[model samples]
Target: MVVIKNKCISVSYSDPNFVIVVVAAAAVLLSLCVVPVSAAAAKQELKLRFGRNGEFKILQVADMHYANGKTTPCKDVLPSQVHGCSDLNTTAFLHRIISAEKPHLIVFTGDNIVGLDATDAAKSLNAAFAPATASNIPWVAVLGNHDQESTLSREGIMKHIATLKNSLSQVNPLGAHAIDGFGNYDLEIGGVKGTRFENKSVLNLYFLDSGDYSTVPSIPGYGWIKPSQQFWFERSSAKHRREYMSKPEAQKGPAPGLAYFHIPLPEFASFESTNFTGVRQEGISSASVNSGFFTTLVAAGDVKAVFTGHDHINDFCGELTGIQLCYAGGFGYHAYGKAGWKRRARVVEATLEKTEKGSWGAVKSIKTWKRLDDGHLTAVDGQVLWSKKSSGNRRKKQIPIT
Candidate 1:
């Protein structure tokens, strides 16, 4: 007698194990259709490299505001005043940026996740870094005011983040400087071959945590960098200069570096006074207390640019004392941002060039611009924001003299 079961037709009495044979055949066919996951499923680290043309592009994704589990409906979000009621599609948005820009390194400036338990927050953060790791790109981040709001402390959150493959954050080991926050660190990006700046780091990247809401009643808005952290920055920059640029008389300038943090500094107020460019829709939501961090940066003369996230609606770049201060705009649907303003990010492009005065290799010019999620682009302040020439030298090459 003939029998049919699902897709297999066989003789019912032909053999006792005829049914088993049909099942086995089906298993084999099923295995053929199953897709094997990529080896990247096992976490891996990637070494960051400069571009072939000695250019390095950094994609800054700010205020991701990723929330764990299903996205909260816009109307259900708390306070009833929050903007952008759409669902928080964090991974999809990040994937789009990673695929389009193909940045060598991605910097999450702040507020990566909000309003979730530690486990969910960790998973949310892991999703943020997944785009970088799967593409073999190195990424780093700093904490925003809301990062530790719900169930995680800054230290607790950072411990989980450090486990992510290709992440550059670590538990602060600088003794006293480790206080209050985590991931206060610096990195050096070396130059490439055939480039004028082959031997040394053409650029330095500084990462610092701009802490959450003030625990003190006297202080307002958000937290500020403590004196100890500023001391660390001064010491670190001085050490880098003394070791790399100062010793070699031929190498004329301090290695050009940029600082990344979550909140804006009080000095960001200077942008209002000066004839600044870019969209300054909202007022600067900086710390009430001036930490003098900006003064230290100006004195060190190494950090020529600073990028921040936090004020989600404002995406602008302005010059202050020859240094370029800019915002990475807001990219999260969970966070409060203007409804009309499209989600956006900041792209910083740096090139190593031969300096006529100092050592042949130094960051020539840093040009930054904004990119909206819909593919529209806006140059900083209506023009391409360019960095000043190497001012670490005494030569008269017309670099912005900060």
Candidate 2:
């Protein structure tokens, strides 16, 4: 079976010498076999390097609706909707995980910079991508509602993405890019192909740009993709499946095609059915809005997974349009990581697993840590959020960031 994924956070095990122990959820036997692929912590020696052969270690990176025009580290800053996030020191918080996982690639699910009302703040948000981009590591990003400067009455947010895109093009053409500034992008991790980027041969991971202030766009609302994009997405998705996954008849996969987007499509938001199977009429800005976009995605969803964020609390799960719709916790959003879950931010470490039948799936887990005064991840709080249940495929726990 062939496995496909673009941005994956995971632990590597090249050896069998290890131990097994579950954290808090032992009933599920969260503790199982363990191994080490690369043991030392991940760090950047001025310049970053990846594991040879497209192989690398896993690091958890979460959202940081950070205040200030900085990627400075944020530790339990609490959920403050009061604005003025651009001035906060977030470098220490960001470096906490950056220095630890030494991730060759950084996966960001969006919502970090909160440029409430100032153009300078928006510009700062745009420039903030600098420090991370400076690391010379690859990154996969999608915008969240906070990235939506539309309602904030600030055009700076959009301008920031544009500026950041231009700056990245000059330094590392492949490093920075916007999926047409619609909150979509794709990058290769461990050689696995995934994303909504323009690439066709890359296993068809189609991400959407559902605009709005984070929530699924409220139909005729501002900032959301127009109804026209759905057709564009449908055509694109169908074409990708036929082009990549040869066996589209059974919807089985040796070649998997997936989709990701920032906001959740309405069909996937159903709590009662959890069916995640439905088309959207598009209405009401206060509640959740559904869209046919996900249906268009899942028509090919059987061989793929639709991943997203916003409404980040413990994480929402459902299946729609034949795809596994996953709502992983946000990287830095204040409200998503459960009320009491400690640690300031988090990163998703997803492992692409292939079944004996040539089917594809991913085992996702979260890793969290705190930013110390010196600017680095404190190993104390980092913990695994999910692991492969394939019996022997447990992920290796993260090393202490001390």
Candidate 3:
């Protein structure tokens, strides 16, 4: 121990009568350098509020499919076509979106990366989420069909993501449930009503792992959300309801929410609404078996819409019953996409009701659209995708947990 200016600094000496302490000091310095820096713990509850103008925007980038290898000709797509996995242009495209949109939150739907080596996969994901992280925007994700196809397992990929700054990704805890997927969790965005101290959640976001392939012997191709996962969703919803809706002053209703995954559900086949605004070339490549996950959402009455990414060429959205079904275009050049097809992303702008002093109104509506890489923007549906009126309920302020 050494005292300087009334401050004591501890120093370890192997010999009690040591005349020279340089070697010990050097060892201490080396130890300090070798120690790993601890990361900030993940949030237990994420908080979000509307902007000054009562609006929040979310940019959804899907099918990034980044890889660390050199660009190669996708023989499956076309003779003249090339994949953009290792192309520098992929980084430029993502940076442009971050600059243009400046979204409050960026959501990567799935297939954010695909690489052979685990280290390369992590590097690719770091590049993919770089835009959002650099802009100080928190990003969340769900696992897709192609995500686990690489050398990295779903848990391993999520663990890598957790190391990133400003990452809000959460996967299923080990041995918690029978669900076969990772990163299945929900988050809520709260809004405060004036200065009266009455605040509550206005929107909920659900991120689920729509698995890559079916485990059943007979079924092939796409995977479906398992019944255990559905049960997990129900339990989560119930807990949220008990936390907020059970309050004496709480409004009696379901909180409006949105679900994002990789593969489209089988029920998306019934999406024949005439309100389609975007393009759809390939048929919906949904799971072979209807897992009733859509039915679970409908019964829960919280999920207002579902967005997916597996079908790269399909970027259209339409009403499936009362809920909206939408697809974001493939954002990666590495993915299997039409040669001339424009790479695009989906933008969801939520409109919060303008509330008077001392009182708050629910979410007025949510408008969704697609923005192509060329900067062109158009609504997913010509009409409003989801309105408070259409939902038959208004989401009131969720009381802040004091």
Judging by TM-score against the true structure, name the best candidate.
3
Q: Once superposed on the true structure, which residue ranges of model 3 sit more than 4 Å away at CA?
A: 1-46, 69-86, 116-119, 173-177, 193-198, 273-275, 356-360, 375-383, 392-402
Q: CA lDDT of 110 in candidate 1?
A: 80
lDDT of 3: 0.66
- Candidate 1, residues 111-156: lDDT per residue as tens digits? 8877453246667777656666687677778888777765667888
RMSD to the hidden true structure, all candidates: 19.9, 16.0, 15.4
lDDT tens per residue, model 3, 222-252: 8777654565576566655554575544757
Q: Which 10-residue span in candidate 1 carries the lowest summed lDDT?
A: 1-10
lDDT of 2 by residue, 293-321 (tens): 55555454423455555544434334433
Score candidate 3 by TM-score against the native.
0.79
Cα TM-score per model: 0.76, 0.53, 0.79
List ranges where model 1 is wrong by over 4 Å.
Answer: 1-49, 74-88, 116-119, 173-178, 193-199, 246-249, 354-360, 375-402
Instruction: Judge candidate 1 against the unseen true structure and give its global Cα lDDT, from 0 to 1.
Output: 0.65
Candidate-wise lDDT, in order:
0.65, 0.39, 0.66
- Winner on TM-score between 2 and 3 is 3
